[model samples]
Target: MQAFSEILDQWKTQQPEDNRDDYYKIFTAVKDFDKHIARRYDGLRNSWFLGTVTALLAEKIITTSDLEDFSEEAKSKIARALKFREQYEL
Candidate 1:
C-alpha cells in the first residue's frame, strides 16, 4: 500500500549512521506490518468483505461515500457494524 511504502521509505532518512539500530527498527517494522497484512489482506473471502469495509471505514482508509456503489442492504450492514464498533469497541 502507498501508506505502508511511505512508512518503510522513511527509514532511509532516519538514523542512517546506526546500522545496528536501523536494522532492528526496520526488521521489527516489517515483521509487524507483515503480520497485519497476513491477517487483513490474505485469503480474503466474500464473507469478510462487509467486516473489512467496516474496519477500513473505522480506520479512515475509506470514506463513507465509497459505499455508494454497494446495495443499500450492504451499506446498512456496514453502518450498523461501524456503530457497534464505535459504541462498544472503543
Candidate 2:
C-alpha cells in the first residue's frame, strides 16, 4: 500500500496544476484529517488516508465516476474510510 503522502505526491506530479492554491486546499484538508484522527483514535488511525479522496470529491477535483475505476484495494480503503466517517459522524 502506498503511504498517503506518496499518493499525494504522485497525484501532484500527474495532475500538474500551474496554480497551487487548489493543491493547498487538499494539503490542508489532509492535515486536518490527520489531526482529527490522532485526537479521536489516539493514533490508531485508518481514515486519515481518505482525507485527500474526500477533499478531491468535495472540490470537484474528481468525480464519483472516476472512483468507479479505482483498483480493488483503493476501493476497499475508500469504503473503510466512508464507513468510519459515517459511524463517527466526523
Candidate 3:
C-alpha cells in the first residue's frame, strides 16, 4: 500500500483548497466510523485507528510545507508534526 505521506503529497500538489478543506472533514468522519467499529467489534484495537490518524496528520505536516505562507496556522501545524521527527528531540 502507498504510504499516507505519499497520498497526502499528491493531494498537496493538486492544491484543491476546497477539497483539502473537505479532506479533513471526511477524514474525521471516517475516523469516527472506525472508532465506532472498534467499539462494536471484539478484536479492534484503539491503536490501529489512532495510528492511521497520526499517520495522516504526520503526512500533511511532515511531507510538505506548501501551507507555510498561510500564517501561524501553518507554522503551528508544522511544529506539531515536526515533534514526531527524531531531529526535533535534541
Candidate 4:
C-alpha cells in the first residue's frame, strides 16, 4: 500500500490549478486520519475518512468522472477501515 504522502503527491500532480486547495484539505484530513489510527481510535478514523471523502465529493474536489484517477489502494484502505469501525460500533 502506498503511503498517504505518496498518494497525495500523485493526486496533486493531476489536479488542475484551481482545485489545488482541495488537495490541501485532503492532506489535512489524511494527517488527522493517521493520528486517529495511531491512537487506536477506530471510530474516529473511519468517521474522518468518510467525512473527508464526503466533503471532497460534495465540494467537487473529486468527481465521478475523475474518480478513476484516485488510487484504488487508498480506497481499499478506507473500506477496510470502515469495516473495522463497524466492528467496534455499539
Candidate 5:
C-alpha cells in the first residue's frame, strides 16, 4: 500500500497539470488492487469483497462527496455496483 501511494505521488508530481484525473486513476488502481487481493483470498464469488468495497466508498462519500471526481455516468456505475453489494448479507 505504501508503495502504491508512492507511485501515485510520483505520478501526480510528474503530471501536475491534471491532478483530478490522476487522482481518479489512482482510485481505480486502488480499487483494482482490492479486487485482486479479494480474488486471491476469497475467489470471485464472494459478496464480502464487494461489500467491503461498497463500505469503503460509502465511508469516503461521508467524508467527501466528490466520488473521486466521477462524472455522472461513473457515479451511476458506482451506484449500481453498491446496489449489487447491498443485496448480500455482509
Candidate 6:
C-alpha cells in the first residue's frame, strides 16, 4: 500500500503538459520502484525468507510489530539481523 502511494506520488508529478525531462524523471522513479519490488518479492523460497524479512525491516517496508506473531526463535534471528544492519549500515 505504501509503495503504491509512492508510485502514485511519482505519477502525479508528471503533468499532461510536462516536458520530456519530466517524463524521464518519472521513468527513473518507476524503474527504481521496480527494482525495490524485485528485491523484496523475487526468490521468496523458504530458504530465502529470513534474509527477505530482514531486508523488509531494514528498508522500513515492514515493521517489527508486523512480525510480532512469529516464534521467539525467529524473532531472535531477526533481531540479530537488525543489529548487523545497524553495525554495518546495511
Q: Of the candidates shown, which would achieve the greatest TM-score relative to the real structure?
A: 1
By TM-score, the candidates rank as 1, 6, 2, 5, 3, 4
The sequence of per-residue lDDT tens digits that candidate 4 reaches over residues 1-90 is 245667677667776667666667677778977885565444556547655664455545676455565578766664565455567751
Tens-digit lDDT track of model 2 for 48-81: 6466675456555677687886788887777676
Among all windows of 10 consecutive residues in model 5, the one with the lowest summed lDDT is 44-53
- In the predicted model 4, the residue pairs found to clash are none
**What's model 2's TM-score?**
0.36
Check candidate 3 and list the clashing pairs: none
lDDT of 1 at 39: 99
Which candidate number would show the highest lDDT if scored against the true structure?
A: 1
| Alpha-carbon runs more than 4 Å astray in model 5 | 43-90
lDDT of 3: 0.56
lDDT of 4 at 82: 48
lDDT by candidate, in order shown: 0.84, 0.66, 0.56, 0.61, 0.66, 0.81
Q: How much is the lDDT of residue 37 in candidate 5?
A: 71
* Window of ten residues with lowest summed lDDT in model 1: 1-10
Q: Model 6 segments beyond 4 Å from truth?
A: 1-18
lDDT of 5: 0.66
Q: How many steric overlaps are in each model, in order? A: 0, 0, 0, 0, 0, 0
| Candidate that beats the other on lDDT, 5 or 6, i.e. the better one | 6
Cα lDDT for residue 64, candidate 6: 93
> What TM-score would each prediction reach against the true structure?
0.76, 0.36, 0.28, 0.27, 0.35, 0.72
Q: Is candidate 3 or candidate 5 better by TM-score?
A: 5
- The TM-score, computed over Cα atoms with residue i paired to residue i, of candidate 1 is 0.76
Model 5 per-residue lDDT tens digits across residues 14-49? 978768877777788899989877765675455454
